[model samples]
Target chain A: MSVVIEAHNISKRFFLGERNQRAFFEDVSVKTIRGLRRLARRRLAPEQSSSRDFWALKDISFQISQGQTLAIIGENGAGKSTLLKILSRITQPTTGTVKVYGRLASLLEVGTGFHPEFSGRDNIFLNGAMLGLSRKDVRKRFDRIVEFSGLAKFIDVPVKNYSSGMYVRLAFSVAAHLNPEIVILDEVLAVGDTVFQKKCFDRMEEIIDEGHAAILVSHGMAHIRRMCQICLWLKNGRIKMLGPTDEVASCYEKATTHEVVAHYEKQTAEQHGPTHPSAIAGLVQWSVQSKAASAPHSIIVSQAKVTFRFEIELTAMISHGKISVSVADAQGLILFTQQGELGQITRGKFWATLELPFLPLKPGEYIVTCTISEADHPVAFLRATPELTVLKDESLAQSGYHGVLNMPARLSVEQIPQA
Target chain B: MAQTSSAKETRVQSVPEIVTGTNDALPSAKPTYVVDADKILSSHPKDLWAYRELYLLLVKRDFVAVYKQTVLGPLWFFVQPFLASLVFIVVFSQIARLPTTDLPPLVYYMSGIIVWTYFSNSLSQVASTFLSSGTIFRKIYFPRLIVPFSQISMNFLNFIGQLLVLFGVIACYKLSGHRIELSLKILALPLVLADMALLALGLGCIIAAATVKYRDLNIVVGYTLNLWMYGSLVIYPRSAVPAHLQPLLALNPMASFVESFRSCLFDTEHTTVQPAVIATLMTIVIAIIGIWCFAKAEGTFTDSI
Candidate 1:
């Protein structure tokens, strides 16, 4: 298939600055002062300074084939709108190049190119022609456009009087009806209510079915997954990942999760150092003991024995210390916490064992954090080590226990005869 | 067409297959960076030609909508200037005793008002083009120049309508035993109107560009036009200025334009040829600057607006 749109290393830079009042005044004064001084200075001066440049899009490159839909998914400020503007030719790129093979119609913003003083009918033709449709084409599709907009009665009225929803509906109808070879939409589906948004998505599907290319920039991952076969995840103005929708989305989710974990680690690192006078400093190690040496890294609830060993370094160890062990779910809801009494505490190395008659947690992941404190002052703390995982038991299938937690209950039912 | 279709199909298949298989297998086409300035410039004229029908639709809209709900309808085009000329003739000529440059006071003031009306109307409307057309400009991709161009054309139609009324007054004055000499140099009236339109458009483009970002230009434009009218000798003759202020007065381009227009229409002898040349040069210079500013602003005005 032929590539309908190709953007190569496209970067857009915008410079923002206050007007140079001093330079302007000095230049004006120099022009007035006259003679050979201005001539000599002009010959000697280097180029003038521009203010500061902000990179809205930094080296973004992608290509779209004809009849293919490429979905761009990113958080706000990810340069989606900037890329669309460059593609639409509404703005020029500061660097790099974008080549579009055929006619491009961009619905970057709804109700663009609408003259409010003109009647809706006039604006339809005006906006249609602006989108690259000829007058005859607009005339040919005139009735269908108005019908789609559901504004047949209001077509002759000025658009300034249109309700916001009616205005967007009419504007979108004109854009879709114009039928340019490449369509670029930027979050315009968020306009109108749910029913109208569905109508728009249906229309977009129809347009795609007709074998024209489209680039959809949307925040809704579900929408992208549904409508687009290919997805590009943008991070900080560059393509983070681009490929199949599911793969790219999963990668994006993983990267976001890692970011959150990194942030949490940074926040917790400053509070605590070490609890006891062990050789290793600030290290709490927990491992599950199994006959199989290559058992999966995470601890399961059905494990034979779980050992939590705390190794801490003491700056100056004098007296009593207690170690608290807490198990929490993913949402940081503590299911349980156990405090080893002072008699159980040794100088450096601390070992604790908790035995369960039956594993309490069903099937899910959980975290275990250890806090070591002396008289309520936290001396050392460590978050989850070998993050816990619980697997579903096939053996328990007959018992009717089907979830993450197993609660034993007995019930007796008595049937009453109904007439 | 068949080749395009099959090629498009093949391209579509290739993209997903290559992407799904391996990223390294994709075609190695880097972006092109030739920067075709001619292509950009030609896009404007091409769009104008392609969108000609829309331009006519806009012109039709300008004509009908201006007089649509008014009581007098299109007749007000003639009624407005006729009444205004009569008032100017009475107030500025008879009451204020302003000097008329070798022509009847009514004919002289009416000629100036006729040309002044076209320039002022075009100037006022052109200044508002950015704000007025902001809605349309933001949504679609057309040459931004079209709005102001269409505005000037619409005002041109109104000026021609009012010109007929001026001709009737001139004919009536001729029949009333006053010798109204007809000069062949009156053929130059179109040139004067063209110059006025260009000058107005250039100034309007500058004002429109400024108004998009500053917003204060809108207010400044309204008041500036009023002050501008007094300086242009619209109500009185250019010769009425004191000799010392003549050079400064001559610097106002509209003064020379109006004076030159009156000379052509009324066979007046006191024509400021030097000032007219300066005014024409100024107009051209302003137009070039305006176009350059507009081209630079076009890229980012969407964001600012």
Candidate 2:
């Protein structure tokens, strides 16, 4: 396939410093004072005069062949939009070059270049012109644009008078008529009604079928997976991976969960048994451990046997004791709950452990709750928290099932004789 | 061989690469456009030419949109300059005792009002080019000069409307058998008009480029333009100035254009060729610099904006 676009070693640096902080007029007004300050500071330490730089994109490179669509996926500040801007030629990279062998049209924003006071028809011609189409070209596709927008009636009315819905429809219809060989789309597809979005997808598919190339920046994963053939996963302004969509997508998903785990870990505080000795003397030690003590509970594989252990202290004698263990998911939805009666405990300290043969949980972090109270009276109690995470890597799950239960389904193949 | 690295493109053969037809090996002669930091400072004239239709369409937008919500619509175009001329007659001719040349105060002030209003209004539009269309600028890439250039097209329509009123006033004089005559200098009308436009465009481009980064210039420019109105010979004839300040007054490029416009109307012969020539040369230089600064700021404006 012939390459339609080639980008090489692109980097964009934004100056962000005391001098850069002030824009044009502010810079002029404050120059004398800043100059004076600079002179004094330079006499002491001259190296501090340098302006700090924030590289929005760093040494990025990619090639887009005809009929290929590339998806750019990243966390919010990962330079996805910056790269889009560079590709669209709205901004210049600090260094490097980009070559495109086809006519290019970009939709970085929904109806961004529309004149509000213009009539729908006039805006179509104007926006078309803005996209580099001649007046004749606009006239040719004018009817199609009107028909697609369903704004045929409002074509002569000023767009300011049209409802915003009608405005977006007309803008998008004009944009859809572009027959350029290379298309750059930002998240502008998120606008308008669902029908418009579907139409946008269909139009994109039609363009790709004609062997035109597209570079897209969208956070919608399902759309990315469906529409894009290749993916660029940007992390902190650098390409973390550039490969087939599925490969990069899976890696991105894993990284997202890892971030979630890191965020969840900060909220958890594991305290040793007795911080408040006088406050609650009901329990001396409470912890959750693996039943076999072979695999650490810190990394619990799904369907693994594990135990919840607790030690309770009776400063005063108590009768008809009870114990309960509740396993809650990350969002605090209780997935499993178990309770049993404990006969009278009149001792200083006592240990109780509850073991499950199979965890029967999905692969995720869970909060474990243990409660001890008198059987008849629900008031006397001690509760301890131990967070649990069930690991269910495909290679780790012996039964090879992903969800809550791993049931083994027998598989046998029998060859049928040719009829 | 046809991969012409610049965008001065020939017609592209719009065939799909995947087509298994016999023409597959035909060198798909399409021009290539390479963008880098170095290209930021240079204005791509070919790209601008290709999108020239958008400029006309934008001009149409400006014209149609100006009177959009108003009930009077395009009629206000005639009313606006006439009213302003009346105000000039009342304020300057009557109260300030400014000279009205040999023509009636109404006609003289009307001539000045039409020319000055077009210049000032177009200049104001140029000044606000970035702030008004900043949303469009951030969203897409087009030649930034197109925004300011569209302002000229919009003002030109308004100028034509005012010119019609000027002719109507002049016809009344002719019908009265005053024997009005045209001078050879009147033939220079198109050149003078172009000078005004270039002056506004060049200055507007400079200010538009500056105010985007130093937005505080927006308020200052409005205030300055208002003060600048008095500096020009719009309300008074050039002779009204003292002999010592005559040279100082001539330094303003609009001085000759405004004087020449009046001279062309009444054959006052006060139109000096020297100032007109100076204004033309200054306009050319300003146009070059203005375009340079505006184009330089265009590429990275999104980051600052």
Candidate 3:
């Protein structure tokens, strides 16, 4: 396949603060006055202005051949939008160059040039022209675009009166029907209802199958895995990783989960601030451990025996205290729960452990919570440190595993023979 | 093309040498784009040609959309200059007793105002290209020139409407026993209008580029146009100015166009070929500088905006 896009060492720098808003003439005059002052003082030191510099992207380079789908994945403010803008030629990079070999249409934003005052039909032509399609081309694809948007009845109505969803559908429909050899999409797929999203996915798949090159920026890891062949993970304006979609997506997902867990830990600590460190009686420390994993926060094998341990420091003794352990997924849905009675406990620093013979959970992030209650009222709530990550067992590593469950089951080959 | 390449070499130090020097590898006859920090000149003029359809559509959209929802619609175009001219007749001719040439006061003030309105409208519209089109410019990439070009086109349509009204006023004056000269020199109206457009586009481009960073230019532009109209011989004929101030007034780029317009329609004064020639030359020079500044700004204006 011939290379359709080639970018070399692209870097973008922006001035931060009030200086960016200064007029060109004002900036020039001020600089000249500053230089005169320096000359009058005969100072040799370099002049430093008040404005700070921010590099939105730094030394980024990549290439995409025909028929290749490249996905860019990163957290917010990770310079993903900046890169797309540069590639689409909406903005120039501070340094470096990009060469595009064919007709390129970038849908960085749907309804980009749509005028709300104009009817849907008029906006279709306007948007098409903005996307580099001629009037004749728009005329040819006019019916198909309207049909795809399913707004045939409202084609002659002004878009401002249409619902937001209808507006997006029409804008996206015009872009989807364009016959550009290279396309750049920036989170435009995460729009409309599920049915409409499915149509967009099918349209994009068809475009890729027709041997067109594409660059996509999306937060959906599943979409990236399903649609893209190559992935570029950006962190702090630099390429963190670049390789096959499965490899890079998995790494990005892990890093993101770790960040999420760290954030959650910080929030929980803050919520527990006034009640912690000086509390007369509460759970002080907790850890999740499994024999199949080295790290206390991770489980490396499927169906591993796991232990949820907690340490309690109480000023008074209790006779009817209860300890409960619950395992929850990332969405905070409690997947498993068990309670145990603590018979007559006089606590200084008492260790409590809840052991599971087998943990029937998939290879993903999960939070284990422990609660200590007396007389049906909870006194302390503790979450395991570092969260829990269930790594896939290499022996059972198959691509078919779906959803968040790894329950052990046996398949019987004795089939029911019905004539 | 040769001039552009040479200009690229002499200026724009950061511009890279063409990366795809040869097109042997391209499988089809598709256009290629080379985007760089300083790649300012190449392919834009061609892209403008290729996007002519878009240009026409934009002009149509702007032209239609301006009056699309108005009750009076395009009738406002004719009413605007007519009313403005009536106000000038009251303030300048009737109250201040400014000397109107041999032409009727209505004809004189209306003609000058029509031409000035066209010039100012084009200038201001083109000047605000970035501010007005910043939304579309940020989201999509097209030949940015198409926007300003379309704006001037729409303004031209507006000018045509007011021009027809001017002619009607002139004809009415002719029927009412006024010996207003309808000279053959009127044939030069198209060239005069084109010259005025070039001047507007050129000046607008420079201001648009400047205002991207210093929005104060926008306010300056508003009042500067008012001051500029006073300087131009729009309200009064060139002869009405003190002889010593005539040279200073002639320094205004628009003086000759207004003078030529009056001479062409009513022969109020014989317009010398020299001023028109000099003004046209100045317009071309200003236009070149304006286009250069605009091209440089388009690459990075989105960042500032």
Candidate 4:
């Protein structure tokens, strides 16, 4: 289990002020003026120029040994890509060191350096050279590369006429056939169709089986969980957690949902001000409350009892009215829908409450909406809450089910002798 | 080593027997690389050696891709210099009454045009190395010098094409019985071309490096190269310049190479050894500085661009 990559205290700094999008002449004039002003103020304000320094990555360190897969997970702008760039040696870290013990290949972009005017055969050689393969290496693997891409029939045609699927297939085929000791991949799996995706995954598995190490930066948690043995979670350019894949992945998922909930809270606070005025005919205001509230309007998983309260103001007499409360996942996929008949009311304000004996949901972010209808026509729809965040119940840790439901089922085990 | 057993258990157990044999052989010796922020300004000769094949392929690509789908194709190489020399013969040799150094005006103008074309084209092409291929440079990692080297080599092939046309013109002049002396100094033509190439590469490297930050250099370089041709003794021979301006003409490094190349064909020596030696030394110094600037910018240009 010899180490293949060892990154030590890797920190990268960037200056935000260096990005100049002005015209050439304007840039010259403005930069000169600013330079003179800065020189004049040099003694008084020494920190004005240094304020533009941005630390994209801060004190990040990790190591991967032979035959290991490491997954990097983070939200956008969490320095995941920067760390990959440093590891790939495409960019240098400002204040750290990295050591590699074997041949390293980085696939930061697919079909990089591919000229659209060049035929597929010529591009194969060109791209292979760009990826660090010698001419002899490419010539030896030429047949296998074309065969894997399934473009042998069209190898002489220019890639500009290639369908996007064929283009990605050709690019991925060359990358997969690279026989390097260590491979760095950045979200390259989310390409092509599902069948090809599976093929790519299989090839990746084979690469690892051949005693190669890989470091992957991907936003797909499913892919990370299935392929990576270790996970590194980044938060604001620092390591939030690093450990076994399952533990770090689950922690990252939980924190991500919490952030989603906070985002929803902020949006609702801005979109709907302090007043809750009924804009529809029937439904006025509706709210959800749980006995075990982790935060304001949040429910703990396995809450046993949950309540949905609604205020309805009917302007005219309504016949055959119905009200329903539905719980949906973050993506608006309805998980549970329950309907109750509304009592006949004429021209007045009334309160209706629906109580459930037990609500079973996994720890995540969800939405609760209340709908009021008459004669099978939906009249008024109201969001019951900003967002429903189901907190984790420590007792459910032993249950090894991964879904939106936490079913209440009894388990019994007994030892029996084999005959 | 506590995680070693767990790591082994998680790896695929069904690896073929031959794959395991390779694993046993790997730990014996392996290459290790250390990366840090401080990159050397000098080019890595070993890395350049490893990528020599890529350099060749790039040159081939440049050669093959340029003439594709053209009307005359490779003949355009000959047509370009011939056309330019025709204009020079009309303006300088015929109207301005410039001396042809006891040689045919076609041969005199053609030789200077081809040699100057080689030097200037190489300089401009190599100067735009980073600007034209910033996309490729940002995405891929290779020996950066390969680009400048490949540009120079590609222009060399173009030089050869135009040289053949010059030779044909000389043969036609000889068939017509003009007193043109063919000397062994023509063997030194390759050395003259090499000197010009070193000079172009050095200047191109510096300009390419500067243009990464101050892109104004790209625009300025195009016009400057055009103006630079007149300063050299391309259209007029060195013997045509006044004695007071003779030293000024020698100050331009390209003047010697162009004069030397013309002398190689006409059997006349107009440039002295001192100017040639001085030009060579200047080319060497400029080349060293150019490579230094190019290597310095190669490591961090992506951030600025």
Candidate 5:
């Protein structure tokens, strides 16, 4: 296949002090005085730290062939948008040249280059032209664009009045009908409701099938896994890994999962200030921990105890108290509960531990809830939720493993039963 | 192109056509693009020509959208020039009693204000191109000239409206026993209008480009235009200007632009050949410089804006 897009040695360096806004007088005069100061400072130090240089992208190079799609996966600050802006020609690369071989249309953002004041009909022509299509081309596909957006009724209405979903649909519809040889999409698929997202996916698949080269910046592994042939993993603006989509996706997943270990203090809003005068004790902090409270990211396996530690601040004194706990999935479905038991309590700080054992849950995320009470009367009730995750055990067969259950099971099929 | 070259940062110090120069093995069926470390000039006039329909649509957008919301609609267009002319008649003729070239004060000021409004409108619109279009510029890339060009085009549409009103006023003045003769120099009205547009576009693009970094130039532009109007002898005829300063003020391209434009309507002295010729030449030079500045500004502007 012929290469449709090629980028060589693309590096963009931005000045730290450079600001983008300029109204007439407000910025100009200040900028002028500052410019002179900068000149003097440059003469004195030659490499003033005030005029710092930031390399958004450094020595990046890639090429995409016809009908091939590359997924660009990275964290938020990994220069994904910068690379797209350079490739889309919205901004010039500081020290590189990007030569697109054919007509290029970039959906860098939804409703980008759209005029909200313009009616949908007018915006179609304007947006199409901005995307390098001529008026005749936009006219030819006008009905199709309206139909694809399912916004025929609102085509004459100004886009400002559109719900965000409607605006995204129309914008995507225009981009979907683009016949350019190369299209660049930047996280636009993560928009609209599920049906529209599905349409976006289907339209993208259709575009790929039509042999147009594409470069997509997205975080959705399912979409990337389905549509992308290759992937480029960016870490701090450098290519960390680049190869087959499945392999790179797995690498990214592994890296992210292992790196997500965090220490979190469950400080509720009311717990931060003074407790009620009548209250004897209040919850200070609660945490869900793994091993020895060093890290919290590890997944709990089947039938293993996961630690839930709670800290309480006693205002005056309490004769006896009991703590109740409940665990719920993300959808608020209570999966486990521990009834309160009376215990002797005193003034000042208090700490307690609850280990949830035999959590017969599948590999999914769950949250914990806790409350404190005395004599069946609530003194300080904490409805705060802390989250925990459970990973599937490798020993279990990956069949009938949907929903929130991982019960032990034995299966056998004997031919003698039929005889 | 089907070439097996290693992917490396070329750091193209200049242009990178040499990459293709060495790639003799590349398949001719495919096209290739090499991104270079250097900035490339991208103001292809042909690209603007190709998007002509978009240009007209945008002009329509500027014209129709402005009046789209107003209850009076396009009558606002006539209201501005008319009121300005009426003010000039009251101020310049009644109070100051400025010398005139044997034409009715209303007709004389109408011609001058008509020409001046077109010139000022084009200049200010083009001047604000960077500020007004910065949002569109950040989100999309097109021929950057289109923003300034569309401003001039929109002003031209308003000029047509003003021109019709000028004809109506002249016709009315002729019925009121005022002698107004059509000078053949009126045939050069198109040339005069071109001069106005070119001068505005040239100067406006420079200001637009300059205002990107040194925005104080915007204030300077505001003051300079007011001064420039006085320098152009728009209210009074050229004969009212002292002979000593006549030659110096004639250096202002707009001086001759306004004079020649008014000379087309006023049956006044047709001695505008020299100044008009000088202004036309200066307009071309200014336009060349303007385009150069604008081209240089467009690439780096995204960084600042």
Candidate 6:
């Protein structure tokens, strides 16, 4: 397979200081530190300075064969936009290089080249020429671009009057119809309504099927998985992993969730350092233990019977103090918080058992944060503990099907005659 | 033989690698510096050759759009100067009783207004080409100077329209037995207009560049043009000013251009010869600085804008 795109050891460094400030000394210091770290970690480390460089992309090397779809995926600030900018020739790489096999067109931002005062028809030609299409080519595709944009009736109108949706549709229509060897799209499909997004996705799929290579940068993992055969996962500025779509996606999910956990840990650690015992005083550790000897390292709620065990080390005996165990989603919305002393042991250690009869939550990962408090004061706090997984219900058959909820009900049906 | 073979292999490998490598770095090639006259002029000749259509379209747009939504339409082109000249004749000649430079008050003031209006309007609009057209320029790649160049062409058309009205008024003066010279030196009017356009565009480009980063220039430009109008002897003769300020007024290119234009029309003595030469030199200097500043700012305007 012929190589269509190649990025080799590319690195980009951006200086983010204020324009008026003297950046010379600060930039020198940063460079020295970066150089020292690179030398120190020569063997064990990846030889990439991930911090302080703000390296939108660092030592990123990749090759794409002809007619291949490569999905670039990561969380926000993952250098996706930087990569696309470099590829689209909007900016230059700080170090390293990228070679393209043919003409490349990018919709980095929708309506990037539209002129407000120009009529829509005139803009189509202008925008087309800006994108490296000849005037004759624009004329040939004019009708199709107009039809696809659904702006046929208003083609002669100046684009200043175009609604935001109409503007994006028209701009996108011009971009999509341009016959380039490589098409780069950066989250432009997120524009317009849901139906329009689907139409754009379908059109992109069609374009990909026509044997032109594509690089799609999106936050939507499902979109990436469905459209791309290969995926690249970026963390900070470096590629964390790159492989087949499923493998890279799974790695990305793990890395992202791990990052979230690490971030929470760092924040809480900072809040309650070893010297600041008063911050999380009074209460002790809590653990969720499963009875199954061969239980999976992680318990999925739909299938497992897990017990809520608490080891509270109270500094003082308190009356009417209760423990609240809450399972919160990623947005910190408490799904369930139980506060009771039904099966609690009075003095030292308390253990409570709750078996989920059926899993009501969707199949995804969630965090369980527990807090033991007296009225308004929290004595102890546990955030993001026992990362719970809710698995598919089919796997629970051998374990006697312990669902996520336990409920008791009575039902009676009495049939009456037609008369 | 061994060394040559190794060198040949390195060369073979390096060529493809370098070609593949720099493909992504091609677009951001705008040079830095504002006063690089060679670079600025060099960019213009090619751009003029390449964007001939764009130039034509810009000229057409300026002509059509200027009067498109106006109440009087294209008639305003004639009406503006006619009204201004009438006001000048009454206020300066009749009320103030200012002396004319060997021409009738109406003809003298009208001639100055005709040339002065083009210079002042061109300067005002051209100074704002970056600010007003920045939205279009940011998203599209075209020679940045084309905007101010197009404004010059646009103003040229309006100037021509006003010139026709001036010609009609001149013919009327002639028909009424008022002595006027139709000298062949009137042919030099194009050169005068060209100098004025260049001076306006050159200084305007510099101001436009400054206005992008320091928006205070916009306010200064607005009031500065008004003061500049009075300074250029538009409604009064240079002799009305004190002797000490005469040399200072002569330094103003528009003052010289307007004086030359009046001399060409009314067969007055060429009092503008010295200033005209000075103004021509000033135009070249301003053009150099303007192009220099514009080129330097073009690379980063996308961020600032």
Q: Count of backbone clashes for each model?
A: 8, 2, 1, 0, 6, 10
Ranking by DockQ: 3, 2, 4, 5, 1, 6
The Cα error of candidate 6 at residue A12, in Å, is 7.4
**Top-scoring candidate (TM-score):** 3
Candidate 5 per-residue lDDT, tens place, B1-305, comes to 10111132212122211121112233465443333456654546877887777677778888878887799988988888789888988899999999768888877787777788888988988988888888777767678888778889898888899889888988997898878886877788898999899999999988888887776677888778887888887888788888898888778888888888888766576578898898899999999899888887777777775
Encode model 6's per-residue lDDT on B1-305: one tens digit a residue. 21222222211111112212213443333322111112221234564456656665666667776766689899988888888888988898899998887677777777777787788778888888777877665444456676678788888888888888888888998899988887777888788888999898888879887776666688898788888888887777777889989889867888888777787666776556877898899999998898788765664454444
CAPRI level of candidate 3 = acceptable
Off by over 4 Å in 6: A1-104, A112-135, A156-163, A206-215, A226-251, A258-419, B1-69, B95-103, B136-142, B182-189, B231-233, B236-250, B260-278
Question: Which candidate do you rate higher for DockQ, 1 or 4?
Answer: 4
DockQ of each: 0.20, 0.28, 0.30, 0.24, 0.23, 0.06
lDDT of residue A235 for candidate 2: 71
Model 4, C-alpha of A219: deviation from truth (Å): 0.8
DockQ of 5: 0.23
Predicted candidate 4 versus true structure: per-residue lDDT over B53-161, tens digit per residue: 8888889888877887688889899998889889988899889999978888888888888888899989998999988788887666777889889999999999998
lDDT of each: 0.69, 0.72, 0.79, 0.76, 0.73, 0.67
CAPRI class assigned to model 1: incorrect
Model 1 off-target regions past 4 Å? Answer: A16-52, A116-118, A157-162, A190-193, A255-419, B1-42, B62-87, B171-186, B207-220, B238-250, B269-282, B303-305
Q: State the displacement of the C-alpha of residue B292, model 4, in Å, after optimal TM-score superposition.
A: 1.3
Best by DockQ: 3
lDDT of 5 at B185: 73
**Local lDDT at A293 for model 1:** 24
- For candidate 5, what is the DockQ-based docking class? incorrect
lDDT: worst 10-residue window of model 6 chain A: A398-407
Taking all chains together, each candidate's TM-score versus the true structure is: 0.68, 0.74, 0.84, 0.78, 0.75, 0.66
What tens digits encode model 5's per-residue C-alpha lDDT throughout A205-237? Answer: 787667478888887766787778878877667
The alpha-carbon RMSD values of the candidates against the true structure, listed in the order shown, are 10.9, 10.6, 8.1, 9.3, 9.6, 11.9
Q: Give the residue spans of candidate 2 off by over 4 A.
A: A16-52, A152-157, A264-419, B1-31, B41-43, B177-180
For candidate 1, write residues B27-138 as lDDT tens digits.
Answer: 4454222222122421456667777766766777777778866898889877777687789888887889898866787777777777888998898888887688776665
